[model samples]
Target chain A: MKKKNDWPFILPAIFVVAVMTQVPFLLTVVYSTLRWNLARPDMPIVFSGIDNYLFFLKIPDFTVVPEFYSIVLQTIIVTVVALVICTVIGFLFSILLDHPIPGVNIARTLIMGPFFVMSTVTGVIWKTTILNTTFGWYGVLAKSIGLAPVDLLSYYPLPVIIFLFCWQWIPFFVLIILAGLQGISGELVDSMRIDGLNWWQSTFRVKLPLIMNHIRVAVMLGLVFIVKEFGLILVTTAGGPGTRSYTLPYQVYMQIFSASNVGRAGALATMTVVLTLLAVNFVSKSMKKNNL
Target chain B: MRANQTLSLQRTAQIKKVIKMVALTVTIYTLAILYFSPILYMLISGFKTEYQAVSPSFVFTPTFETYKSVLSDPSLYGYLGNSIFQVLASSVLCLLLGLPAAFALAFGNFRKKGTRDKIYMWFLTTILLPPVAVLIPLYTWFHAWQLNTTPLGLLMAYVGFHVPIVVWMLYSFFADVPTEIMEASEMDGCTRFQQMMHIAVPLVRTGIISACLLVAVFIWNEFFLGFNLTGNDTATLPVYMSRFREQQGMFIAQLSASSTIAILPAIVVGWMTQKSLVKGLTLGAVKG
Candidate 1:
């Protein structure tokens, strides 16, 4: 039923998406160019040109916590580490589930439960109940057994955040690779026997290769999702303990709400976008190269 | 002697298989319990008194006090109801706005497939774009228009964020609707709208439902946008829940009760759409 010009049917959606996504992006870039500090009434709004960009760019050291460059590195490390660990654990679970074990049905549902939990809930649950030093479940268990309950939140905040990230995200990898593994034809498994391949050999060779694309999808999606890990950070540590747990997004939030530095916020956001685009470019290029 | 040796080898192999099966079952149950322990712990804590809830004691008398206290707060239900309403509203809007576009892309007699692919990728990029980039400008624009805290503005934003998934998922669905049916409907003097409403939609009802479910879950769980955009009347459950967390005292039991309330619907919807969720989340790139 589509005519030669079906563009009219699509125009409204295109308009709304562009207005919401595209216009905001352009405006963010434009905002970065201005000295729009709401807190500092003494300094009027003016064209700051590339000054805003330089503000983040001119940070001298790469090791400084809460710094733009450092936060970018930290975000990458946290996201990549979490993604890798989650993928490994998720793949193991997927492989375990691939076999027809007794009571697998109920176990599968239970395993998938954490993925559905809200970000704030996961963060708050972990922070207040699971990781709370004096009153957490661990504390209760430890004290019952005649041991001291060390404060994980105070000493190991970033790892705790990463653990929370993995807990919430590993299930995603399970979903991805399990779908891929289920797609594998039974004939392939039969052929594994014909080829004299052992069970471990069959999984590593036949099963893993078949789901390489799915693994790639999981990792790529992880990159896309993990960078936006704000809600979890906001509730758990709020990037606390002197910025040891800070990420780029958290830093961006601080720049706006904490400092009220609109210019610097805009500039910092632009840099974050650039950093994200670089990873996106890599993902897309690798996706195409891998013929995914 | 050869028959006896073969029989012994086969028996040993059978024993190994049984052991492996038992181990896998044990591992599955163990991991499931470990993975779900956080939610279970929270649920238990919700029933514990304030001291025991904080103490994390296992041997405490259970109580419904926190649930009662949290539930008695009228605004909790209001925020939850608002979340439900907004999610439903945005999902419907996503479908209404996205279906036509998806249908156009899937069945249109476009000369170049590349144009179609590029347009689809453009939308895909928007979905993947770090939402923080847009937050500063959107907050400003919404504030300028006094639409930041309004349901209508928030609805539009959710629809915009969610439509790309709808378009992509429904594109795959509509593509599966055999063209012969559409052509036959066209021959019977049916309009494009009628063809979609009468034929294509009914054929792929499961697809549309799954797409909406996926979009609803995403929107319902979304934070940054809801956190920054809405207030008071438009406060989403997530934003409201965050506000509760920020308040003075640490009430783990109360917080758990609220968290359970906020997450209950998502769990139900998520379970129902478990299969289609993979498709919706991956935009039909990977199907379960």
Candidate 2:
């Protein structure tokens, strides 16, 4: 009776999750194997096993490698660089805020402000106010110093995007690491100090090892966020300069909305799901290992 | 012997204190500037006149014209209303569906743990899948259902996309509540619903609030889903802001103002719940 009663309560949520998330994913896999386009409605969905995948592999786009590899490479580069920078900086900031310093709360608030700003806002703020070649603050400053103002969007698209990604995501890492820092028992650190360990030794030998799980979680969350990021790309470059800034998600958007190739877009989406699953699985396994 | 040991301990503490202070100060200042610059720039740009905003000169006359422009537009209010309605409806629906499911999973020792875990994983896996993958087919599906360009349609989609994360976050929070509390309530003759309402609800209030705030911010800031799902009639702030480029051209100050307006609510909420906001952002890490 108790078991039967519980089923009604659980069923709605499970139903929603299955229908909304799982079903779409399954459909994406099915669509990837078929040939369909937006232009023709009456045309039957043709079953072309692996054809779309093969075609995508051969296509030469600046975003991906060889033809499609560049995009993936650029994305990997951006994600890695941004993750490393943000994690280090975030750790540093969290350590700072963890101190018994006055105004730490104020400083923390100021630092966290940017994270709340939507990606669209972040993109616009960087592009128009700071990096705009013609009228941006950086451009103005450069020109005043008797130097040519380089258009960030035009000259260093990938770096600019990577920098923005770092800026937006750093606070997230800071908050997480700070929470983890708080969780560390003070007595443990005191005991390490009593054993004649220096601050560096304590941090490296004691503090860091304890927070490994947190760090893993932070990195995984960061990876998921960076992989899924779209607003910044959309607002800033719109995957511009002939697809130089195209990442996997943007490519999927272009294929479906712009190119109207439903099957190819689905194929890209499937690949994204597979990659994300791999990342999630890897992170979870490492976390489990750390716990053990 | 004790005095000597104490003296040596004091000296070491002093040295450690100095190093820690120096490191903390430097890190704090650098992080402050790095994180705060873009937001400061945006807020400053919003107040500047078009000419001042565009000029190479750092010093400029500020004006309220941009704010005036954003406020005077009637559609801005409409967009704001639509955003509020959709976010509130979706969040409410997510909680209604999510809370019970979370309760059942956390408390009920269901027989099929494997099936349950698989379902949970499947839901989380949606976070990994990009929207464009299913965009076309979903579009066709929505169109067939006559849900395109409707607020209810958009809310349903938002609820669908968000419920998994909501469930996961709530589940973790619920799991942490001491089972003894629920068991105690049962011993006191409280029924399941009564126990959930009177016990579980109050205990997890912080979690519920955090989840709601996080979900609200996400719904507010969501662009692609809002862009694809809603037309002008149902557009949210992100979609409204996107229209600025096409409609207003390169009016830099006006654009900044609109951006500022769009981000204002999130900033306010983030400030209020800065602690939990951080917690929510790093939910995956803390749980793992």
Candidate 3:
């Protein structure tokens, strides 16, 4: 057999990926070392050991609300909250869908609507129409009932933003869990039922164990997603009113675009890169282990 | 006595079935309403007058004036055109660049068995980083090169954005092509490329379509990349939609109306490819 090298076919893909990904990836590391602020180009470009990383971490000036540590804490808080809501609600929805019910297809479509919505539009729809508090539906309903209109985003920015994120991702969890549920053998379920197992017992003991991998993957994907959630903050809060919604990804954007601090932005971007890489590694590792 | 007992048991079962059916319907519909109300309200807002948009109401006379104004706005068309151009170009490029790489992974012969796996892992890792991480540096690089804010830069970014998904989806589909077919093709003097073109590609036509649709939705809705990298002339739909919110502060009607137009295509695509697209999200898990 003639050994034709497949590298010929793959070269275009490699080139594209390299140009788009690898070059920038390397540049991120190298850029982090130099004081590369475009606003202050007169300053000679010199190696600044760990100054960039230190500045972003310490954040001496409190220009933004909830500087540095609060931003990181806020990121973790919102992501975890979103995941919790997504999984709990998604699990219930999946269970509801397990039955052979009428109008299920329509129901599924409705449940999955947010997945189709763009992230920017998602922030807009939530901020203006749903969570606006001035003319939003929630406010209207509250006022109609003679109650004080609650400003959710104003008072509870992280939770409201978390809900918005949950709305977008809950369907994802439902689909994944539903897929996992369907993969379990019907016969095993029937036999379990025959062996005197009730619905709760069967679900917790047999079904949960079988679908653990799916749940884990859903969580891993969700973590990666939350780490990258930037536009939602950009459109809605813009990290305002005291840095209540100031997240790390949003901070990175503000640093580069708003503040014109390349060194700090690069450091922030590097942190994001490490976090995402670890999450991806965890997902891939678990998947490989399960498959093997 | 036996006949009476049987009739009583049947009645109990019948009662149970009725209870189950009613409960299922209630749960399902309730879940649907809870999940979909936000979007439904957004759609409703689009049909109202500005005052009505601000004050949510069920009894107001619905109007299409907002839609009329939004559609007639000349810049809306420009934003739509930019969206269409970027989405179509990136999707096509994803197929062109990713399909071949997928094919290589699926059928490539290498010096070491792990070579394909190593390269494929590297590709998937690229997706792990948030778009911001890439944008922080890529923006600087592209700006220096005068490529930022250009349609060309946006296209290039989107292609990079979507290629990993394309490669992953296609790689799975191509791998599932029966090994026997490839073997037979080899026996019949069909080259690997010929085998891919004639057999593998046709077999995974649905996968290709699904990838295209998914990529299209992502590109069309992509906010950050274009938000940062591209400007008014090159910005896509979501960027324009946000601009409406920022510029026309209380014009809720127009913003929602523009958003409706922006999102209609994605919703249509979603309905069209619901099955395969969901499967793709789960990384090739199809429910049995």
Query: Which predicted model would earn the best DockQ?
Result: 3
Error of 2 at B51 (Å): 2.6
Clash counts per candidate, in order, are 0, 11, 0
Which of candidates 2 and 3 is the stronger one according to lDDT?
3
What's the C-alpha lDDT at position B187 in model 1?
A: 90
Per-residue lDDT over B1-288 for candidate 1, one digit per residue giving the tens place of the 0 to 100 score:
999999999999999999988988898899888888888877777886676666665577889988899889998887888798889999998988888888877766576668787777787777777888888887777767889667888888788788888888888777667889878888999877777788888988898898888889888899888888876877888887666545323688888888888888887798788887675555456432
Instruction: Say which prediction, candidate 1 or candidate 2, comes out ahead on DockQ.
Output: 1
Candidate 2 lDDT (Cα, whole model)?
0.77
Docking class of 2: medium
Q: What is the DockQ for all candidates, taken in turn?
A: 0.61, 0.50, 0.63
- Looking at model 1, residue A130 earns an lDDT score of 65
TM-score, each model? 0.93, 0.90, 0.94
DockQ of 1: 0.61
Full ranking by DockQ: 3, 1, 2
- Fnat per candidate, as a fraction, reads 0.61, 0.51, 0.64
Would you list the C-alpha lDDT of every candidate in the order shown?
0.81, 0.77, 0.79
Q: Which ten residues in a row have the lowest lDDT in candidate 3 chain B?
A: B279-288
Model 1 over residues A196-269: C-alpha lDDT tens digits? Answer: 99989998877887787788778877888888889988887778787878898888788888787888888888
